[model samples]
Target chain A: MTPSAEDAAAGLQYSRVLDAPPELVFDCFTQPGHLTHFWAPKGASAPTTEILVDLRPGGRFETLIVNDATGATYATRSVFLEVHAPDILAWHEEHTGMTVRVTFTALPGGRTLFSLHQSDIPDQVLRPENRAGFATTLDKLSNYLHHLADGAKQ
Target chain B: MESMLKNRPPGSLDAAFAALADPTRRAILTILADGDATVSDLAAPFAMSLPAVSKHLKVLEASGLISRTRNAQFRPCHLERAALDGVGDWIEDHRRVWDERLDKLDQHLAELQGGKEERDDS
Candidate 1:
């Protein structure tokens, strides 16, 4: 029952330029071997994992990640809404009722500018005290973007 | 600040989401955002009956989105912006999660590409 307005207000976005070409970057997502190596967050590793990808509109994709420390397992189930090879990927994650879209822009010199957008965030994140922490995160992101831009200039 | 929310009763988040889901309820929150108003003032804006508006207000109040107070005969409802702001924070948390994951992903991609190059050279 997350308010639709909140979803609109809270959509997340980030973009970065990666060293690899678009096709290689795209393959990193579609291929299970590459995905399993990098899909987990910073602290966790995907071990004893199962990944199934159908790679078409309305096709299903799922990943099961196990926490190394606690042995707790988390599963992410999503259905593809759109898939354009080496360019765009969009899916609806069933667990959080969120839609994620990622775009790969091919650049000169085998580099790719990758952009990500996610919307319809779930409700649990709204705990009252987390408000300040949220502001700090945005600051961090702003700094990251500025740093990236500065590096691009240099 | 952590203890501030910890002190609040549980399920406030669920109630807030449920209450805000309705368009009428959201509009009511918007109207109240201007300033506190009596039940009748809020009911006048909508085509629905006063009772219906009251029902929406009741839900909002239960969700901690608004607080009602009585002064003799006037029961004015005040907007609780704090509750809605919590949602904005939650969204920030969502963005951070992806940021952290992508950082890891950046490293992984570097390793994958590096390994491929080494294999090709050999």
Candidate 2:
């Protein structure tokens, strides 16, 4: 599924083309076996025991990541908002009030372009005025912070 | 396993989100990010009246995004670094998590497909 203009403005977006088929890439996200192999960040591990995926709308998709060095765990609980195999997977994270949408598109040479977009839904859904300038504001803030850091270094 | 990371207080985050919703308030933040500015200084760029600018400042101030100095007559608003950092950090942290996970997924896919090809040959 494509992100709307408002969603694009207020959301965090990331996309990367992987050297695999869309079906395989989608399975890596939905299947516990594939997810257990790479669900957590580097240095953190998501055990199959803790990785749960009920791949239907309104179903649960949860994971627990344990930091290898710190032994710290981060758990996420989300409900699937949309689940269309090999194409789209969207979920609403309960704790953060953020909805994450992931799309996988087939490329020319057996590759898949995986894109993820996350946005805070509650405020954006309630108020329309807040949507347009969010991403631009963030870009300005990020640049400003970088400038401050650069000045400090010099 | 114990959950190590605690979620940020939803109230403050909610306020920040709400405060950032308006284009005017966001423009105010952009102005303050470069340097602190008074209501008059902020309002000049937008052609907005002082009261309207003050209203946006109030929302920003309440959200802890900007603080106004009490000593000066104009009460210049200073951007609160912590609040801005909080919002940036939240997004960055999630982005980092997905980035790393996707990197691993790339490697896993190669291995999975390699094993399948080997099996087909055998």
The candidate maximizing lDDT is 2
Residue A72 lDDT in candidate 2: 95
Q: Which segments of candidate 2 are over 4 A away from where they belong?
A: A1-4, A69-74, A95-97, A121-154, B1-30, B38-64, B67-77, B115-122
Model 1 stretches with alpha carbons more than 4 Å out: A1-10, A123-154, B1-85, B115-122
TM-score of chain B of each: 0.68, 0.68
Candidate 1 residue lDDT tens string, A1-154: 2334333222455677777889988888887888877787755666424888899999998888777788788899999988999999988899887678789999986778888756555555555555554333334433433332332221
Every model: iRMSD:
10.4, 10.9
List model 2 lDDT by residue over B1-122, tens digit each: 00111222332544565456556777788888789988889999999899988888887887678898989988999987666766565555666788788879877987988854422210
lDDT of each: 0.67, 0.70
Q: Per-residue lDDT of A11-90 in model 2, one digit per residue for the tens? A: 45567778888998998899888898898889989989998899999999999989999999999899998999899999
Estimate TM-scores for all models.
0.57, 0.63
Give per-residue lDDT, candidate 2, residue A129: 45
